[model samples]
Target chain A: MNNRMILAAVAAALVAAAAPAAQAKDWTHVKVGIEGAFPPWNALDPQGNLTGLDVDLIKDLCTRAKVECDLQAGEWSAMIPSLNAGKFDLIMTLGINEKRKQVVDFTVPYASGVASFIVEKDGPLAKMPMTGEKLDLNDKEKADPVMKSIGEMLSGKAVGVVQSTSHEQLITAYFGKDVTLRTYKNSGERDLDLKAGRIDAGFDSGVYGATLPSKPGNEDLTIVGPQLKGAMLATEVAIGMRKGETELKEKLDAAIKSAAADGVIKTLSVKWSKLDLTPTF
Target chain B: MDFPFLYETFLTLIAALPLTLQLAATAIAFGAILALGLALCRISGILPLDWFARLYIFIFRGSPLLVQIFLIYYGLGQFREVRHSMFWFILRDPYWCAVIALMLNTAAYAAEIIRGGLLSVPHGQVEAARSCGMSPFMVFRRITLPLAVRQALPAYSNEMISMVKATSLASIITIMEVTGVAAKLISETFRAIEVFVVAGFIYLAINFVLTRLVAFVEYRLSPHMRQPAPLSAATVAGEIR
Candidate 1:
């Protein structure tokens, strides 16, 4: 009986030791999925590897969260499915939209930005938006008139937007029949088409538009039209986690809150996006 | 299927048809020429020529076409010299890059098919041609090439349908082909499975038409051979042991 007790104690101790080790490793083994082509957010450099703002942001967030992360570059359209399939634990650089809320959970908004139209600075449709202020799509009064003015300018014009994005939805929702909205699989290709004069304007995030001038032949392009934000733009960009990842979400949310409180977010936002994307709420 | 949306999807995919057709036609046309050259080199009796053809075929046939497309589009785009060189203008566009990858891949497979066709030309036929005072070129042009192509037609048609399916991958590089448009439609609606199914059906219809066309061509070319009629149950049973 005494020997049996001792054996039971030993087994219990061994189980306790192994349990903590696995838990500790679980926090360390983070697989981060990113859409590598979404530029300034995440993009591939000359080495044909992933890079950019989200790349930097993910490293910073993981370091702050005290986790070792493996960044996996995935095609944008398949990112969500890949994440759900357990190919990765987190999706780093996607906007927190209501539609996505049905599928996945998100951390607190790490960054907030607007979507805008990009057109040639000297092109015929350049000066038409005429509004200098960003438009909040949440308000119908403002959204209706603003969309009308934007539509008039966009009439008979080719607008390029990335597939499976709020920008594409916005273009289709507001100006479906009025304008020719061309969707691209990635922003890189749309940017190329814009530079090649195949597209009159491309609608993408303002953050991405800001980096367009840095591309080889896009020096002539400029952000035009009203910057669409708020409801139509989705909630904000956050670290997306699969639904049911409650603990992980809490951990990320806390880390994000701590980062924001420490001004790390503001610093990084200005450093990467060249603008203060620090969330107000 | 939502009738309106289905109709819209068809119209949208159809609008993108020109680009898809252009990609397939251009790739197959160029690939056929390259295949012929590679096939000849493969069987040319010269060791260097055979080795060169083998390596070319192996490299292209071994790797996934997606990797090949990416290497051509983004990989080659990485080099400063490639960007500034005369070929940069062509390489800069995703359309041409996709075409180049497709052509190269098809050429590798097509070469083997053509080579098989060439080998299928019986020794008796060549011997008979030579016995009739036919020169080598005449024998090859009339007997070998024709016989080889006939033998290769079935396999080549499979390749042709595969090429059509392969054009779907071009969407990754951002060409607004049928698959690209379908992806966009799904993104807006979030009905991925539906849109993809519709897109797949379009490809199926295209392949179905192509299969019939190839069958027609096969029948026209092989006039000397008699095709067996559709087998009745009795006929099938009679052939069984």
Candidate 2:
């Protein structure tokens, strides 16, 4: 009876020791996923190390949240599924949209951007009318004529956009019928196609599109057409989490709010993207 | 379970079939010619010709098809001379670039198959043909070529099926084949499994038809291999008695 009581006490002590660690709200360690190919956001540097705005922001956010972060690189296509499968606790550099919301929850947007088109400097599309205007895709009254003009200009021409992106959705919605759409797995490949003249124009984030023309071999490429916004093209860039992970989401959201409040996001944005993309809300 | 969505997905995937078939058919057709030439070079007595063929096969068959496609499509495009030259006209189009890559890759594998087939032709049959007073060309045409083709058919059919599937990679370079369309659908609906299931069905259907066609060709090519029909049950019982 004494031996039994001692065994029971030991078991109780072990359970007591393990329970709090499992139930603790403090996420001491986290696995975060980011598409390392997305430059100026999250990308690998010369020595094959992850570096960019998303990398920097996640580091700061994790530091402030008192959590150890293990940043992982993953393909954009695999992000949601992998997150849901518990491969990672959070995904950064995700664009918040209704379609994605159905599969994963998003933290408060840390940044926002518009989509635009890049074409060769001497290409036929260089003379397009709306070079710098920001057009809302949701405003049908404003968008129709602009879309029609774009369709006319790009008829029978091939346009490239990154696969599984808001840019692809916007291009498909607006000009899918008139122009040929080519979707690439990454922006680098799409940019390569653009420089090769295989694609007449490339549509993607205005910030990303701006970086392409300045590339060494891509000097001939230039950003043309209107800066596309609203609807599918305008999206709030945020971190993605599995559905029902409200605790992690809230924790990250708090970190983001603090980062924005302290201008950390703005500073990182300017450092990486060379523009201010700080979210107002 | 969503019959309407599956049907819609099927229809969308079907629209991309023509491009997929074109890539596969063009690659296989061109690859067969290149393979025949390479196989001949490999078997030729000259050291340089055989060495060139062996090295060509080694490099192409050594690398993954995706890497080859990327090198041809993107890597070559990086050169200013390539962009400025007349080859840009062909390289500038992703479709042609994919076709070229698929052809080159398939030709390497097919060359080995063809060479094996060529070597497998019975020496007795060639000797008999020559003894019958046939010229070298006539002997090759009448005996060696037919038997070698028959020997290579089964393996070549597998190669054909592989080429058909390989067309899916063209989507990576932005050609909207069946897989590309399915990927787009998945992106829109965020339902990867359903879209991919439909796309898989389409590929299965295509491969099934190709398999049947190859079987028919095999049947027609080998008349001597045909067997007599089986007797009916009653006839078999009566004969047993």
Candidate 3:
């Protein structure tokens, strides 16, 4: 406790100390941060090098933007705080949402994907109604009945969610009263519990929906429930930066647009996640 | 400094304080019994018991508490039989899992403290008690235990304070203790600084009371350590100094 307190205090001090150093930027060198754990987005390889869709996408974006970028891997929790504290200039594979926009700015979304639940292949929720279907949460006329049925299916059952993700918020808002929530620090931990039957199902990215079931140890898992987007569930992925960095935001936004126009995002998304996540926007 | 938000955060955190205190109290209480058992085992002179206690201490003490927590919570679930066992009811709840982890971790550290206190019992004191026709158990009960506690009080106080702080780690397991609530608040609001400040203050306040309570206990145990009562200017009779 003492150590963390002192470190937070020291970080605040460093932010203050580095304030003057932020006078003006030439935009030649940019420091980018990634979790390096979220597979298909950004992750470390066996050789301890960063690789994944976000890694590849960032490289192309930086090249088009004509900025030299340095990539660093860190814990997910530290990404935003470190960015706000000036430790990193940009964070990759960030999901854009209103709650997050209050604290940081985001470039135009470069990729998009739906979120859904994963259950044991033989579990009661394995073939829930609306499975293999997609629903826009904003389209309440079509979504309401499906969501109500899904909620009924989840009632009294514990569902696992990764902490701080939009999925956590969505589940809480939609089924907070009916379902028991078990928040995890990461999807992998949540998966372990789900496989163990400690949780009835797990809510996560479509990448997990697409990739996790085929992974070695997760063979029994199957994606269930409707693919959900819009509203609290942020499907659009963007590069997060400290709020008010207009110059950097403009440069990155333009780069992201260029990359999307070139099919780079769609190509890399397939290479990493095998899902074409290029956003229509 | 958003005073209103800080105050609101305080209310939210304070509401969760009982859980934080409950975890600490439960851990400290049960851990004390476990610690006493291990300490006895360590000093009981039976080789197997001593080695068993030593091994228990070595493992729990050596590994990080977070790993132990994950092991007990997530690791144990990996075994199908354990999940199906009758004890699964107890092991299934995250609350109990956290309690079990906290209790075991504290016991390891407290065991050493208890052992040190027990070993600090002077040979002459035990010898005197034996010469006074007291049975070994009586000697330990009336003399050795009391003196050991007094000797161990200062160091033991530090352990108790740390155990209070250690309860914060239970947040990771989703216990919604003070730290847990603060974390969720930060994640939702993205206001890390205010939430952390509030949470830290909650912990600080708890430990402050804990230290004062421990100090009071120490004072009561050490009547001899107090300064002699000041001489009264108003004398009674002739026997006054």
Best by TM-score: 3
The true-structure Cα RMSD of candidate 3 reads 5.7
CAPRI category for model 2: acceptable
Q: Name the candidate that leads on lDDT.
A: 3
Q: How far does residue B25 in candidate 3 sit from its true spot (Å)?
A: 1.2
* Per-prediction DockQ: 0.17, 0.34, 0.32
**Model 2: per-residue lDDT, tens digit, A1-281?**
69977777786786457432222355788999998987778788788789988899999999878789999988887777677667888988788877788878899998987788889899899998789888787898988898899889999998888888878878787777788888888888888888877889888888777666665777888888888778866368888887776777778889999999999999999998888999877
The residue ranges of model 1 lying beyond 4 angstroms of the native Cα positions read A1-29, A43-70, A215-217, B1-148, B175-178, B181-241
How do all the candidates rank in terms of DockQ, highest first? 2, 3, 1
Cα error of candidate 3 at position B142, Å: 3.1
lDDT of 3 by residue, A1-281 (tens): 79977777777787577543444567889999988877778778899999988888899999999999999998776678788778899998788988889888899999998998999999889868888788999999999888899999999999998778889989999998799988877778788888878889899888756888767888899998889898888789889998778898899999888888889888888887888888876
Write candidate 1's Cα lDDT for A71-147 as tens digits. 98888877776676578889977787887887677888888888888888898878866434678888889778878
Root-mean-square deviation per candidate: 10.7, 8.7, 5.7
**Model 2's lDDT to the true fold?**
0.86
**Chain B TM-score in each of the candidates:** 0.91, 0.92, 0.94
Better of 2 and 3 by DockQ: 2
For each of the candidates, what fraction of the native contacts does it recover? 0.22, 0.69, 0.59
Clashing pairs in 3: none
